[model samples]
Target chain A: MNTTGSTGLRPILERHESTLLANWITAQKAAPTYRPDLIKENELRDQCRDFLRALMQAVQSGSQNVDGSEWQPVRDLLASISRSRGKQGFSTTATATFIFSLKEPLFQLLQQEYANDPKVLAEQTWATSVLLDRLGLYVTEVYQQTRDSLIQRQQEEMLELSTPVVKLWEGVLALPLIGTLDSARSQTIMENLLQKIVESGSETAIIDITGVPTMDTLTAQHLLKTVAAARLMGADCIISGIRPQIAQTIVHLGVDLSGVTTKASMADAFILALKRTGFAITRPTAGR
Target chain B: MERIPIIRMSKFLLVSIQVDMHDRLALALQEDLTAKINETNARGVLIDISSLELVDSFIGRIIGTIASMARVLDAETVVVGMQPAVAITLVELGMSLPGVRTALTVERGMQILERAIGPTVTEGTDAGPEE
Candidate 1:
């Protein structure tokens, strides 16, 4: 209702809807973000048409701000586009460019329509630029949130897949670790090892850290905690795959590992465990 | 009127705790186990705690105390059949129950006791089939 110097874009957009859409599609196709492999040309045109229609409806409500309740449909449309583009492997800039690319075609149209009035032209062009910038920023924010959640999900999956308990022999269990040992990961590893120990009723467990890259004080403490827990369950834990560097690190950190049994390789630990469990491994005669 | 039973084997006393142990129950079991060890001159004590799904710091300490008591009475204590969750909890509580021997099951615990008691005592039992 506040029509003072309004120069609302809805009338111009409605009058030349076909021309605006044709020019906007051309502009989008020319932009660097346009991907032919991920999206078909028809799908891209449909998205552009939907976006223009939503923008016209929003502008008819007389609020240039994208955050206004009148722009809810437009916001929803951009949010969906951002999410899909993110899933399609579009970079943040590519997703945001979907909105920014409309600037050229609309600005050209605005110049042609308001050429007779320079003052009105300046105001309308500035308003249109600000509006488009806000929309572009909104799309970028949604895309970022989608990417963050995707990363979070991948991290959770990695944590689940990292620790695997393998039963090497009848009474011997091997847990091969493959990543940095954080507190959360340590908790999972401890629980998984303990559960396998109980289920198998194994007297010996070999924790192979060959795939683990670093050894810090906290990681050392977590390892000790896991060993202690396994011991408490009537199972012995043999920390194998101690690279020479890790051995030096452990000693320099002053972690008292004398109470724990450490082996240079899983084979040595397995042999020791077999010996303790009262089993002997002997090679048969060659010609017998 | 509630008491944990202590069964006498050949040279070992079996204490199978199948219920959620409270404070009084744990204390009573400790006293009863020590008295039984002293009375029977038992060589080993096998405690089956596989049924215990939960354990606090107090219960963990009680287990330690029981083992110490049995040791003082000339009986080696073997805690057996501990659930995985209970073991993790005990370790988290920082009470790994040091000086206590542990076995995965009651049969293994009995074997440990049989081995600890030497061949002289087990030679006679070896004549018959073990259940």
Candidate 2:
């Protein structure tokens, strides 16, 4: 009932809570970013209702500062919503629109409350805009954090997935490398290859690079470094799977791969490895 | 300075570095190994460094120096049992220890030595029939 402009938004929100909720839902439903496919209408309605209730409770403490402790529940609600939306594959615009869309219905309420006083209406509208903007930005921050963690987890998984050292025969180990070899990934590959070599006490290691798409000088250098490390560990390393283009690139770049024995395919490398390890495989006779 | 013992095996000299070597000790070992190789007329020298976890550029260079010195003395040197970390560190340090042979274990080192210089010669008293 106190319609004075000196009072903050709490009174206005309290007097027209239902009307504001209804109008806010209408505004959100009509928002361009609203995703009916991603979120059910009932679920969105529940989220809006809960957010409005938390906002009302927090504003009752007379603190317009969003960072104040009274706004803890509001922050928690927004963060949860943001994180959930992020996991649900909502775009940044769509997630941000959840908070920003409330501005339309809110400005209408402010206008009606200060119908005779344009100055008060303008002031309240600006304050509401700032408040909602801060909330929207907070939601984006949480959503970005979720996305970053998701990316970090995927990178770790990819690193684990890419490098696999297999023991093809006794005294022979095979390391099949896939994907682009960056410094970090090459470090991992070297460490993994060396560890397996030590564990198996293998005499020969075949490094198959068939899955590797391109062979730049850097990749070749990393390959040479790994071979050198393995050799220092008393394991002779052989590089295999030199596609014609990669071979031409190495020759064009004037990289010295003479020290490393290479084969055109992994099968040839495996046969040579078996020979070095003094193993012979003979095919079975036609019938047992 | 405590001298690293150079044990004379059949046709090879074996040096196992058990403790961390100081600069003086490494120098002493280097002199002792070369002298021992000369005195024994050994065909090969096997240095076991499995227990050595940490190696700096100095030790790496010393090993390289020993291998080169042995090669000059008409003897093959096989550095054996180098750990993976030591190998990576050596590679990173750009010391590949070229011209020196390497093996996974002392057994393999002996095999390499045997393959390079033939098997140990038997004394006249215990000569056995050839297979």
Candidate 3:
């Protein structure tokens, strides 16, 4: 609104100002029961827009005479805006605008004063790296927490899901898996299988996945890697219970599993493995 | 539980075959070739079946797939170092790798790949017969 001697770059500032007003109007219209008395949201759109315009003018002209102290007012305005909007409204668009508006001025100041200083450059780089690292850690922690909550809810829904391991002859373990084999579950399966193999001194592991819906290149590669890792520890991995659909998917995806021993079912895999180790299933037939 | 080794060279993808692959090697070959074609612009692929004792229809299908994929990607694909027993078994099963290049050794396969990539030096350029 202070239009004295603000000539060049006025159009760009006017555009941004209009956009902010439009966005604020839309936000207010969308609210179920808008409160007029909320001082935080009442003047935020105009205040922030004005502050940004002033900051841009100061940066463009390289005028240090124009008070840089106006930045605190802008920062305070953003803090209040963030508090009023809450986390859900903190979109990338808003963050990007704020960062871009500040970055130009910051870069200009640094270039003017510390351009020749290697120590200052190093310090700035180190500080930026630390900030980025902390941001990454925060994002990862948030994702893990959300995933854990979701998994807990799912577990509660599927109360009868069994985690049982069927023990075969001579320390061999047979795991019958059903449903989809995602990367996370595959990792868990590998960890559990390795631990069981070591603890039971089992030389062979039969993984029955007859109930698996389909297969892709990634899943096939994961299975191959698991088998290879098992061989490294002197144990052989047998994949069994492959459904017809999974076989078709493997062919479709063009993944090669030529070196893996596969069987029709857990029983077949178990018998074959046992026979190789000189053992037989001596139990009598029930219906005969 | 047989172990399969996957080794990658400059322009070749090598997969080592084992005993259990006897039943599915054909299909595996076809699939692997198809993937290689789709994933890379490499000139060739070599399947080393020296350790394999037998070959079957499944393996034959895989090899065919690889060849088909290679053709699509505008690259040449080859199967090399097939053991005598495995070759005989494949012949007995009435299976053949259609449109696929076959080589007797890994060295021969590399040569094929190099040739497919075109002459490394200019056709007319020479070192003047070692002076």
Candidate 4:
């Protein structure tokens, strides 16, 4: 208010907050992204009001940068709204319309206030457009960040869920691995298996690769590395679940698993592991 | 000029490496270990590497060389108590240490020796089978 060149957008918004909000809502509701199923009318009104109040405070401070401290509350509010809207299956365009719609009402007020001064009107209109564009882009950016984090978290969970080390007997542990054995997943598998072996003090570990999709050269190396590590830890490793195709792959690839024990099925591996651990399993001759 | 100590425990010479060995020291120790095997006419060798925290390819080859050398000299060699990190590094470095027998502890190594070479041959040794 002290400067003549100042836009005075703050006072104008404060005076006609309801009228501007009504107009903004009409613009949003008429758009193709108008989703009554996802967001209720009352909730939209509350968000509009909160954003208006924060923007008024921010503009009053005479700071041009959106990154300034005065705009923090507005940013926080929009980030939350963007994340929730993204989660609710709102399109990026729909979420952005929430910020862009306010420009209509805002431009009208600025035009009416600066009617006589063409220079002031043009300047205020350009400033409002720039500010609104930044805010709209911020919403989409926050939405994408939220989506990315959710995806990363799910990948980690999948890694942990896939590699589960189970105790087969008193001193024997078995790791039935599924899916492709990449470097990251191999690390998870190794760490989990090693920790389980230490905790159980198991002398024998059987790795069943039945669920593994294919046997590439890299995957074969990872398997051999796991076997060598387990041997170094004083636990001999046996690999099972060698399908005919996989067996052919290993032989065709000329992978040297010479000293290590491998079997065609989990049962064969289990029988061998039990015998090595000095356990005798007798089959029931008669059915109960 | 510090040297790694090689102690004779009955028929098996025990070398517990408690310090990080540089290239020269490791080569020197390899030479000393093979010499001790000949001097004592030991039947088995046990090298405990639990205290060894890091091992490059050079040190890995040395350990492999010593094991094969002992085997050629009519003695069995067992590397015991290798830390997990060192083992992983060795594998990743593409040195599998073939023909090297590994055990979790020195006690396990001794048991493996007795089982492999028979207790009868180790008749009067102080550290053989019994207490």
Candidate 5:
């Protein structure tokens, strides 16, 4: 090995000397089959490492080329690194380090190879940015789709819970409603109850809500709307199963249920419906 | 007009009012119906108002209160036989009849009661009378 460093190459090697030594050792071990003359190999390795270190520093510091001599060292290094890694049984880490060490010099080579083509540079940048943006957008879209599906499932569950069962009593229709009432659920309840009232041709509809946990203004309003819709179909709506808490909430909220008929419980609502239809429930005589 | 006698069905009482009845008469019918419902220990009371041409807010409030009162007594009240136009008008005016069960016709109201009684009672009755 030449103990005297080239005057112009000394600074470049000093800055990246350790990294260059590691890369050179890796390259030698990777290509154990190659039997290049010892003197030539040593000279080529030192020259290549010095050239690459200088090229990287120049590129990072935005320095101008140091005459046409720069191309010679880069070309030789590329040929050697590519040759060594191409051989069988090259360790991946050694090959990767050698390749990465040549990045700055390779870029310089590419710039010279396409020197007259501004369009190539523009296209390369555009393609890189576009690929990056598209990858980001794909990730975002997948997240949103997952969130939307979860919400849809929740809404479906609410609809199922809000299903109103229409029970026929002597021609009157009683819709027994159980479950908590949210805005979405209440809307579904109204739509279903109204549809049943119209389809069944029933004159009375009793809506029992004893199972509801609590009532808010929105729930109360939804109930009113259901009653109105039922009545519009020429069916009277009776609301039953009001818990004391719910009633107090309605009263405290100052919500006027003045025109809405109410039953205390499901049974009461049904009996009222029976009476309206002229079905008299008489006890069986002691002796037939 | 023939007076429709108040009758009890299952746990409910029914008072059928004539169509085109005066508002005062309807109000009186509601009161009388409620009183009868309370006396019979009926679970519910239905006032057949199919004949009324108009349903105002006052009547609605009274009906609502009666329903509420019946609820306190462990009974319910329903207003039956309301016309479509009347129903629409009341809703348009933001009026809700509180304590009453309103039905399109009296018969439908009865069916509503039967269903409310559930399979246990309905099934018991569904069995043919014993020989």
Candidate 6:
């Protein structure tokens, strides 16, 4: 160990790797960032041990500058750990603490190794803190990116799942729209409903908005666009589940519905659709 | 390019638009359709656009003009089989095509045309003689 000006962490880490790992894990569990409920002791211990090995390897390359290619292995290791924790629903702070927890144990080893030289101890500690901070930030960046992509994928899946087009009858189709009708979701709904209309050869489409929470101007325009598209495709669109409050809002907003047919419920719209298609439903009581 | 052929079926003119009509071709069809309506004395016109993938505002206006001209010539016009995407684009472009009638298919368009012209106009149907 070159103790004069060489402050690489390789010597201390190699000498007491197991002890330092155990201390680091103990300190980690004691911190609020650690969640034992999401992971087992053996798993966390394995990650910490692997991380220490990579850190020691990087330091052994004899490079004090963390930005150099020698420290790339350590960065790669931290990034992979952060990605795993990101998928496990770990918060950014918790994931960063995984790298930061090694600080205390490393500082302790440095203090003991350089007890006679306070200036070298302070210098080494400061360098370790700056390097650890950089590594912590890298982990957070990777974790945030993973989380954002995960959220966007889930949102797309939900949008596709929320809007479903059903074939009500031979000449009739139904679209049940649930949740807020943003422009993107509205585009999805329009495409889905129109595709169903074409496939089923249905002349009438009933749009059920019972699951929709509110009626805004944009949503109403989206509905009109869908209706108009259906009409152009040789299909008539009937909007159903217009609650009293929504009716008041539509009237207040002055959205035109002169060419559109609105019904209080899906059943009424279905009956009207059946009538338009020249089908009369007769319930025979004696047969039952 | 060949002009769109107008095939007369019973008392109606069937214009199955199998090609993507440019502005000139559409106008030529419009002129030919009205001229054929006057010569044949057709009661209805069924414009089948199932094969057409696009419809801009100019094409949309031509369709509307044809329908209005057919109405003035004492004929009903039903445009059928418009693709859903084309319809959405037309509506988005602020042309709902209020002047024309639409049906899901040519057969259904004939049914609507028969209904509009009255059931008696439908020749050789199951109910044409009975009703």
**Top-TM-score structure, candidate number:** 2
Displacement of the residue B97 alpha carbon in candidate 5, Å? 11
Better of 1 and 4 by DockQ: 1
- Note the DockQ of each predicted structure: 0.66, 0.75, 0.01, 0.54, 0.19, 0.78
What TM-score does each prediction get for chain A alone? 0.82, 0.91, 0.45, 0.85, 0.49, 0.88
In model 4, the Cα lDDT at residue A276 comes to 83
Off by over 4 Å in 5: A1-133, A179-187, A280-288, B1-131
Residue-level lDDT tens digits of model 1 in A24-121: 88887888877889988999899998988888877777775568798899999999999999999999988988989888988888888889988878
Regions of model 4 farther than 4 Å from truth: A1-8, A112-116, A195-200, A252-254, A283-288, B119-127
Better of 2 and 5 by lDDT: 2
**Candidate No. with top DockQ:** 6
Give the runs in model 6 whose Cα sits over 4 Å from its true position: A1-7, A36-43, A61-77, A115-127, A286-288, B119-131
**Candidate 4, A267: how far from true, in Å?**
3.1
lDDT winner, 4 or 5: 4
lDDT per prediction?
A: 0.87, 0.88, 0.56, 0.86, 0.60, 0.88
Fnat for each predicted structure, in order: 0.76, 0.72, 0.00, 0.44, 0.36, 0.98
**In candidate 3, residue A122 scores what lDDT?**
49
In the range B25-81, model 6's lDDT, one tens digit per residue, is: 999999999999999998899999999998889999999999999999999999999
Tens-place lDDT digits, model 5, residues A30-146: 554433442256654765566456445433443223224543444344445444443423344333344343334333433444468767644433433342243233333434444
lDDT of model number 6? 0.88
The predicted structure with the larger TM-score, 1 or 2, is: 2
lDDT of 3 by residue, A1-288 (tens): 122222223333444546544554455434443444443454645654665665465534533232255334443444444444333343333433333333333333334444697676445434433423433333334444445666787864543342345668785788777667776676566666655665666667898877667777877876776665454334567999887887878878887777679887888898888986678767587546
